[model samples]
Target: MAIAKGYAATDASKPLTPFTFERREPNADDVVIDIKFAGICHSDIHTVRNEWKNAVYPIVPGHEIAGIVSAVGSAVTRFKAGDRVGVGCFVDSCVGCAARDLDREQYMPGLVGTYNDFEADGKTRTQGGYSDSIVVKEGYVMSIPDNLPLDASAPLLCAGITLYSPLRHWNAGPGKKVAIVGMGGLGHMGVKLGAAMGADITVLSQSLSKKEDGLKLGAKEYYATSDEETFKKLAGTFDLIICTVSAEIDWNAYLGLLKVDGAFVVVGIPENAIPVHAFSLVPGRKSISGSMIGSIKETQEMLDFCGKHNIVSEIETINIQQVNEAYERVLKSDVRYRFVIDIASLAA
Candidate 1:
């Protein structure tokens, strides 16, 4: 076993605190990483608080990880010591399944999440990247591009791939009018990637609060969803709408904004279910779909795409000790985008 240190929520109601743990020693295909940064995701809060009902106690919640390899197993060939790498939402899955080959490991029969889930052995709980070190199979780790800063690149592992997978699946690109709902971590990434893919980008946020930031992030238009006229104006105007907001919204109203055969892709998991009318999809042949984070292969492709396009997430770096406060700010939507914890602080 390898000694590891991280911040963990010991119980549902408590704040995350320094906790010491152990990790399995490297297997023949494992790569050991000294974590540098771990992005705090909204789902981290939900899972820690037991809002998702899948919460596992003593949870070290983090998936958006960026670090440098400190060692590699004897059979590893994809990476070596001192190489930049990252691990995302998933750490293991049924790789032999056809779903895995299609980059649909999330749908695999037994997918292992980075944290709060059990491993294949069915007893060892999988800890995540919110730690000083992690050992993952080489197939699950991705090479981070030299052009991207490890800190800012951390969120790309989760939020970045979350948006990229859907956009790529929905074929959001040139001649497409893409509307990103919300202006936070996931939405901002959607805006950037959509625009980069040559789609005309529109930000449909709660209000004009982050309008300027949205436009600066590559949105061609920004509309306040609070204004009734805003919905009227954009009705039947978008080829795709990506809803990144986790709160319950008027789903039917947003559906009304879609053009014929347009899709509304949901990336955020709201605490409460929002009712959707069949008529919403019936009219205009629209569809509402949901996407999870990408598979390992596609996540690597997303990193390569972001690197090629000079794309990286906008982030606020916080020390590991500030994680609790960061969660509060995240709930208030006070963060400009994503918050990444500098893991070196954990060692301190």
Candidate 2:
């Protein structure tokens, strides 16, 4: 085992602090990584603060990871020392399950999260990228394109793939009118990817504060949702609407904006239950659906696509010590986009 340094949430009410833990030695199929950067995801804040109600104490909360390969086990065939790589939400799942066979391992019955969860062994706890190092299975690791910087690309593991999956699933392309609800971390990526895919992108945000940023990021149109006239004007306009905000909103009002047979996809988790009327769906054959992160195959596809288009998150970098402050900023929507932690600061 190798001793690792990181930050952990020892309890729900307290802030994260420096922590030391052990990483298992490389196995025949494992890859050892020296973590270079970790992106601060809103989900990380939720898990650390126990907002999700399933957090385990002393949890190291991070899944958007970017790093370099330091060592590879004898059986690791695809990666070698000094390779740029990344790891996402899950580290393992049932090896021979149907979901794995279908390349949807994220939904497998025995899926293991990268942190705040137990590994497949049932006894070993799985820590995450908030640390200085990690040992992961070669099958679960992804290669980062050389053109993409490790820091800006870190959030691609989670935020990038999360939006990419739904867009691809819905066949977003030329002639499609897409509305992205929110202009924060996930919303910004959706705008970039959706526009790159040839879709006519629109941003429906709480206010017009980020309208300029949204348009600069590829949105063709930006509207303030807080304005009643905006809703009235755009009613039954979009072919697809992807809601990326976690805050409570009127689901039915958004549903009314969809065209006949259009779909409303949710990628964010709101605290309270969303009440949707049957009339919202019954009228035009419009549908409401939800998407989680994508499979490893799809994630790699997203990375390759990003490489081709020179796409990455709009990020603000911070050192590990300032993570707590960053979390507060994230809650208040103070970040221009995403927050990425420079793990090298841990050694200071």
Candidate 3:
């Protein structure tokens, strides 16, 4: 076992504190990463606060991990020392399944999370990347392209893939009229990627305060939900509407924005069940769906695509000591987009 240093929440009500724990020794197919940066995801906040029903103590919550390979297990063939790589939400799953795409692994009954989840062994709990180093199996680790810097590329492991999976599945590309609801981390990526795919992009934010950033990110038009007329004007105007915020949205109202056969897809999680009137979809035969983060194969594809397009989440780098304050800022939607922890500060 190797001692790893990181910050952890001992309980839901208290602040996270520095903690040291032992990680399982590497196996033949494992790769030990010298973690350089870890992105703060809203899901990490939910898990740490025990809002998701299952709260694990001493949880080291981070999955958007980027770093360099420090050591490789004896049988490791995919990577060598000094190679850049990343680990997303999941670290492992039920070994062999009938699913051929591998991108479907997250749906497997035994999907193991990078943090607050158990490995396939069932005895060892998984710790995430808010630490100085991590040991992940070679197959589960993704390659970080040369063009994308490690820190900025960290959040792509989660936010990038979460938005990309749905866009790809819904075929948001050339000639399509796409609307991204919310201009935060996920929404901005939706605009960038949707535009790169050749779609006509629009931003439907809660307010016009971010209109400039939205347009700069590739949205051709921007509207604020605060304006009742915005909804009335955009009725049946979009082929695809991607909802990225967790706060409850008027299901029937947003559903009204979809054209005939258009899709209203949600990637964010709200605490309460949404109330939708059937009339919202009855008129246009519209459909509503939800998406989870992508599978390992799809995550790699998203990263490669981001590399090709020169895309990365707009990030504000923070040190480990600033994590609690950062969490509060995230709650207020105060970040420009995403927050990345410079892991080097842990060893300072």
> What's the TM-score of every candidate structure?
0.97, 0.98, 0.98
Worst 10 residues of 3 by lDDT: 94-103
Instruction: Summarize candidate 2's per-residue lDDT along 53-91 as a digit string, tens digits.
Output: 998888998899999999999999999999999999998
How many backbone overlaps does candidate 2 show?
A: 0
lDDT of each: 0.91, 0.94, 0.92
Q: What is candidate 1's lDDT per residue for 1-348, written digit by digit as tens? A: 999999999899999999899998889999999999999999999999998888888999999999999999999999999999999988888867834366788667778899999887899888987899998888889999999999999999999999999999999999999999989999999998889989999999989989889888899999999999998999899999999988889999999999999999999877687788999898688999999888788889989988988899999999999999999999999998999999998867
| TM-score preference between candidates 1 and 2, better one | 2
User: For candidate 2, what is the lDDT?
Assistant: 0.94
Off by over 4 Å in 3: 98-101
Cα lDDT of model 3 by residue, 87-186, tens digit: 9999888777515546688777778899998888888989999998899988789999999999999999999999999899999999999999999978
Global fold similarity of model 1 (TM-score): 0.97
RMSD of 3: 1.0
| Each model's backbone clash number | 0, 0, 0
